[model samples]
Target: MTDQPTTASPAATSPAATPSPLAQLPGAVGAPTAEHYGDPVAEQRALAAGRALVDLSDRGVVTLTGPDRLRLLDSLTSQSLAGLAPGSSAETLLLDPNGRIEHAMHVVDDGETAWLIVEGAAAPAVAAWFDRMRFMMQVEVVDASAEWAVIGAMAPADAEPSIPAAAPNGHALVWRDPWAAVQSGGWQYAAEAAHPAADYPAVELIVERAFLAELAGLARAGGVRLAGSLAAQALRVAAWRPRFAAEVDEKSIPHETDWLRSAVHLAKGCYRGQETVAKVHNLGRPPRRLVMLHLDGSDAQLPPAGATVHAADADRAEVGRITSVARHHELGPIALAIVKRSLDVTVPLVVPVDGVDIAAAQEVIVPPEAGQSAAVPRIPRLGAKSR
Candidate 1:
């Protein structure tokens, strides 16, 4: 893997001059400042053990308020917003008329208002989409990225209390990822931001870029390891998380991305792309499916993203292409791929990465036939015979 320096402006200083927490990670092969994390496995373990906090401030937050909040969100996003309560969140997607995903978010309702947290670079575009579609709605959308800081914390089951309580003015949501239990929230420390808690433990802990450096050193001193982007990629694949650029594309539909089932609301009334979502849910089939690819061999290099995945015994006929790959010390090489839903899971596939032949075993994470339509193909079992 080559070192790719992060492209975004160093959260504060020059990327070339400032050493980042990402730089401190082991096996960091790239330019160190690139958008990707350096070591993912160590990061996963830190999250699983409840001792690590990852800076996700790069994520964008948009706030919607007023009486039209729920109504407006209901129309735009793919999830039902009617029943959301304080302290909870649901993953959602905003789709184009063709059902292609434009943005994905985690929506949280703080009882009186709603917050949409989306991928960092996508905030402005998503916000603009909402503004154009407002029409006659009585809603107000404001970009809250600057006023708040987003942080992700993973804690062990036994160390729940050790997890910091929600900041006085901040809202925290307990997130369940495949590797860990995460508690995430945003606090107001910028101007006009009133600290909600008078004596919160984490209030004094700065969440700035320099603080990230300190946290990195603290983690190392306390035996909390840092995982690079590669490890993080592998962990996401192992956990079956659908990444943005990998699993979703300009031609991808929300239903096809498997986000509709978890993020879309079939019961919500009219919205921009509602017609297409409803039509697909009631009558159409998703064109593609998301699956996990378990690579063969303990020492094999996971296939590169975009490598063609082919049936090993069928003259290397194409079945799918690898979207993400990682070398997990515990799980060996693993990948995430988008494939034709009708392909037989029993068929073994291979991805040629560099000069190495990486074996592929498909494991379905989302089934097309589960809810949307009968025409959708059923997910095949990769280990059905053994089970």
Candidate 2:
């Protein structure tokens, strides 16, 4: 990667600078926002098949410049990014001292700049945190959320006419979702031999804010179709992918959502919250675990994000709460929920939609037995022979 300043196109600066041309598309209710065009089910199928693009323009974009960009990020975040190569992608987490997640970033480098695609609402704070951490370093942090937009496509990053334009160095500023397979120094808690993420090959492209209009114009001319957040979210839920916006809360830890598969580098050197991460993985289990809920679709109603989940026993004891819910085209209604690690995996669960309880069957993602991979040998009793 060449050492050059990252520049935005001469188009508009912000998503709100002008009404998006996409909002002008027919049946587009939440155009500049996140609403679907017309049919979400069809959109889901098309999006999964790489036939459509999802408008994720509201997501935040932060750029790190200077020679120390990768070094600074590697010294601070959960992933080891000091050697991140241009055009390569990585998912990482920022955690508190207690190991709770603070922010998650999808990072990609075009040599001179490391672009972070983050949740929109957390952009400012993330930038501020990076600024504060740059103590005497050569790295410069820029909250480019206002200057760029993000778009999601379920196609290969190099696919033509589907992905956004590439950078000057011929590198696409695309963060390919790494959840499909475990990364080096990462671990997978899911026991499934065939992971659902294998079917979900998603990529997010960072584009100039003004490019939204061009994309919208393309849609109008029948060049490409646009899908909304709903279709994108449904596919994510079906893939058992954990997103910070949906699955993370103030108390969330990487272990709880099986994020170790892509985000946490267990063997990496010191960083914030590294102690808790090592302790939990080597000797303890995360207090909570993630699960997929197959909800009864008899009523055709889906539960909200914070809907309470209960055990299917007579007392209907509460076990967990749904973090995200969606109606998949083939899977009916499904949800990602967090529950006590001790919750019996075999016991059926229930999710209340309105007033009635919808029966839910749990498909374990992060099992109760997750962690303790180190398997340290037990110490011998006093006066006992060492074996």
- Scored by lDDT, the top model is 2
CA deviation > 4 Å runs, candidate 2 = 1-20, 157-161, 383-387
lDDT of 2 at 282: 87
Q: Each candidate: what lDDT?
A: 0.57, 0.85
The digit string of per-residue lDDT tens for model 2 on 1-387 reads: 321122232234454334456767778877455568889899889999899998887678889999999988898889999999998989999888888898899999999999999877677667777887888999899988877888888975446437565585679787889998889999999999999998888988888877888887888889997887889988999999999988998789999999999999988889988999999998999999999999999987888999999988789998989999888899989999999999999998888777888999999999999989896898888899865
Backbone atom clashes (below 3 Å) for every candidate:
27, 0
In terms of lDDT, model 2 sits at 0.85
Deviation (Å) of 196 in candidate 2:
0.5
- Superposed on all Cα atoms, the candidates' RMSDs to the truth, in angstroms, are 11.5, 5.0
